[model samples]
Target: MSKRGWIIYNGNLYTKKFAEQIKWLRKTAETFDFEIDVIANNQLLVAMEEGCARILTEKQKPDFVFFWDKDLFLARQLEEQGVRLFNPAKAIEICDDKALTYLQLANHGIRMPKTIIAPKVFVSLEDDSHLGQVIEILSFPMVIKETFGSFGEQVYLIKNEQQLRQKAKELQHKPHLFQEYIASSYGRDVRLNVVGDRVVAAMLRKSDQDFRANVTAGGKMYRYQPTEEEEKLAVRCSQIVGADFAGVDLLFGENDEPILCEINSNAHFKNIYDCTGVDITKDMMAFIKETITE
Candidate 1:
């Protein structure tokens, strides 16, 4: 019998890019003789009775799940039922929250920008005195990021105290962080796609218009070769986050050293594929097959 599995994605996001990603994975699985069924996260219902939790779905359960969504609740419930998730719930949870990602990386002595997580606040900020300390440490022209964001949507580069105060007030109620901006890597970054213990593909993203080099933000991608140090750092960061596969973004330090940017648990591989001509889904399926067989 052929191995059976599922590719779970978010139902709410109706976009062509997401659909294409699923298509790539499903097509790759076919070559390995693995039967894959694609399902949306919202399609499955979770039920808990007497402290026992289970997933209620019309579709039959598979031997494994390629969890491509960040629905932590559903992911954990699936794990509880003894279903193996590709990146696992814990890995997704950590990568979903920027503060948690930084904490995990810091604990492991990973090199990254100096970051200070904002305190949890309700409603609005009653006092802005803490901003004084944040300025003293990070100074002017700092980077502010929401703990929960993707595609560089919630990231900002504040040039002065006025903008900082304004952005802080706007995001006071939400989880956010302040960080030292790496001027050396302004408008540029390298994204390495890591599968298991190695980097399968890499691309340099650059934007002349904005500080963020995300492709969604109109950045251009170029095929580039990573140094040995850059490759090692990307792989190590993926391992630290407990991700089976991830897109590891690295920033260039003052002397061209690689600094950790962020890790995407369910990284979209189409852009990397377009730039590098490497189909990451193949590597992902191969890794999954080896893991399941082992």
Candidate 2:
């Protein structure tokens, strides 16, 4: 019998870097007498319309599931059939919805910039009730995001009411947000990979030309120095999302206070490794082994 793991690299092939990583992982598994299988049979839209399993197998009901997408539709399907899924369905939901996660975090005193979730339809814009509340709670230059964003896409820093109105006109058909962008984090934020209640490694992502500091948006990474508090927050985020490990993005404010911006259930690690020389892949594998071995 062969030992095996599944790395769910969902979505269409778009990046050469990811393609290379998949190859590397396949080789690594083969070397260890294990197999790395790419399970594309459980795609979200395909599973919806087809209502069938095309190429999945009972034997391939993975022992270790590396989740790549945040949507739990497919993951929930896997669990009903007894295939263990990482990050669980509920965790996926909480992290997937930016508004709900911050509410929970705020209740726990975890620092976060002001955030708001506006519905797609405004039945009574004249009421000005909820709108007033949002304005009062969050300040200007607030960010509007599409809830599910990755690598810096779908993120908007709304500078003023005119901009917000214009943006709303553009994206009002869909649910969006109004969040306070920490000016201090202007082009700078920390991305920390937390594995199993520990901060494995962190990189400070800086965007000199853009406001979005995510590496995908032209942000460069450097050695990040996080205080114990930030580390604790990272751990807390992991727990909130029910992920034993996650990448926590923390933003610094005018006073240098750490603000929890986003929690990535499946964070990319290449840039961190390239800049900091920290290979979390091996450590993460070790942690997973230890977790199940016990």
Candidate 3:
């Protein structure tokens, strides 16, 4: 019998971009003779009874799940029921939160920008006095990022104390972090898509208009050839985050060295495909098949 699987995505995200990713995965599964079903994360109800958790769904459980959504609770519940997740719940949890990702990478010999995780505040702060220490560490022209964001949407570049205080106050009630801006890589960065232990594809994203180089932020993509060091770093970061596969973004340090930017557990490959013509879904499906069969 053919192996059965599922691709779980966020149901609330109704966009062609998301739909295309699911379509690609399903199409790739056909080549491997794997029976893959697409399901929304919210469609399955997680139930807890008698100190045990179970998924209440009419659909039959599969041999594995390609968890493309960041619903960690659902992912964990499925795992509790003995369903293997491609990127495990713990991995997704760590990658979903920028603070968690950075904390996990700390002391791991990963070269990243100097980052200071903001303290969690229950109530909004009335003044900018709390940002005194942050300003001392990472001065003007720094970058601020929300803990949970994608496509570089919740990232900000603070040019002065005014911008810093404004952005900090805006995100005070939310989880965020401050980091030194990589001037060498101000408008450019490299994205390496790693499957298993290898980088399957890479692209350099550049934006003349914005500090962030994410494609969704109006950046353009081009094929990139990563150095040995860059490739190793991407793979290592993925391993550290416990991700089976990931899109690792690398920033150029002052001396052209690679610095860790961020890792995406459920990275979108459409732009990389358009730029490099490399279909990541194929490698992803192959990896899944090999993992489940073995």
Candidate 4:
């Protein structure tokens, strides 16, 4: 019998872009002669009764799950049922939170920008008590990012004390981080698509309008040839984060050194495909095939 797989995505997200990616992934898996089903996360119900967990569905358990959503609970439940997830549940949870990602990488001595996770604030406090220490450490013209966000939408660049204070106040109810800005990498960064300890493709992103270099943030991408150091760093980051595949963003630091930016367990690959002519879906399927056999 042929191996079966489940490609899980967010059901609530009704965007054509997301649908298109799923189509591409499922089609690629089909070309590999695997019977793959694209299922919505919400369609499957996770249940726990008398300390026993089960998925309340009539469908048979799959050999592997291609988890493309941030639903950590669902991912964990699937793993508990003995279905292998490509990046694993723990990796997804860690990468979903900016603070958690930094904490994990700190012990590994990775070259990331200096970052300070904001203290938890239950209520929106009126004063800027926490801002004093943060401003002193990161200074003005720093970057403030929400703990949980994507596409660079929740990241803010504060130019002065007032902007920092205002942004902090606005985000008091949310988890955030304060970091020193990399001036050398303004409006520019490199994205390396690493699959199973190897860099399949890379692109340099630049923006003329926004500080964020994410393509969704109106940045432009071009084929990039990563340095030896960059390739190693990207691969190492994936290993440290325990990700089977990841889109690792690197910022240009002093002397053209690579500074770790962010890790995406389910980063959209459409743009990378357009830029590098590399089909990551095929590599991903191949990697999964090799992994499950071992």
Q: Pick the candidate with the highest lDDT.
A: 1
lDDT of 4 by residue, 1-294 (tens): 678999999999949999999999999999877899999998898888999888788999999998999888889998988999988999999899989999989878799999998888899857778789988888879999998999989999999998988888889879999999999999999999999989999999999999999989999999999999999999998899899999999999979999999999988899999999999999999999888878
lDDT of 3 by residue, 1-294 (tens): 899999999999949978988898889988999988999988987888898778878889899999989888899998888999999999999998999999999999999999998887889967667589889999988999999899999999998998888888888789899999999998899999999999999999999999999888989999899999999999999999999999999999989899999999989878889999999999998999899889
Q: Which 10 consecutive positions of candidate 3 have the poorest summed lDDT?
A: 125-134
Which regions of candidate 2 deviate over 4 angstroms? 27-33, 41-59, 122-132
Between prediction 2 and prediction 3, which has the larger lDDT?
3
> What local lDDT does model 4 show for residue 274?
99
Looking at model 1, how many pairs of residues clash? 0
How well does model 1 score by local distance difference test? 0.93
Q: In candidate 3, which residue ranges exceed 4 Å CA deviation?
A: none
Candidate 3 has which clashing residue pairs, if any?
none
C-alpha RMSD of each candidate structure in angstroms: 1.0, 3.3, 1.2, 1.0
Q: What is the TM-score of each candidate against the true structure?
A: 0.98, 0.86, 0.97, 0.98
Rank list by lDDT:
1, 4, 3, 2
**Clashing residue pairs for model 1:** none
Give one digit per residue, the lDDT tens place, for model 1 in 190-263: 99999999999999999999889999998999999999999999999999989999999999999999999999
The parts of candidate 4 lying over 4 Å away from their true place are none
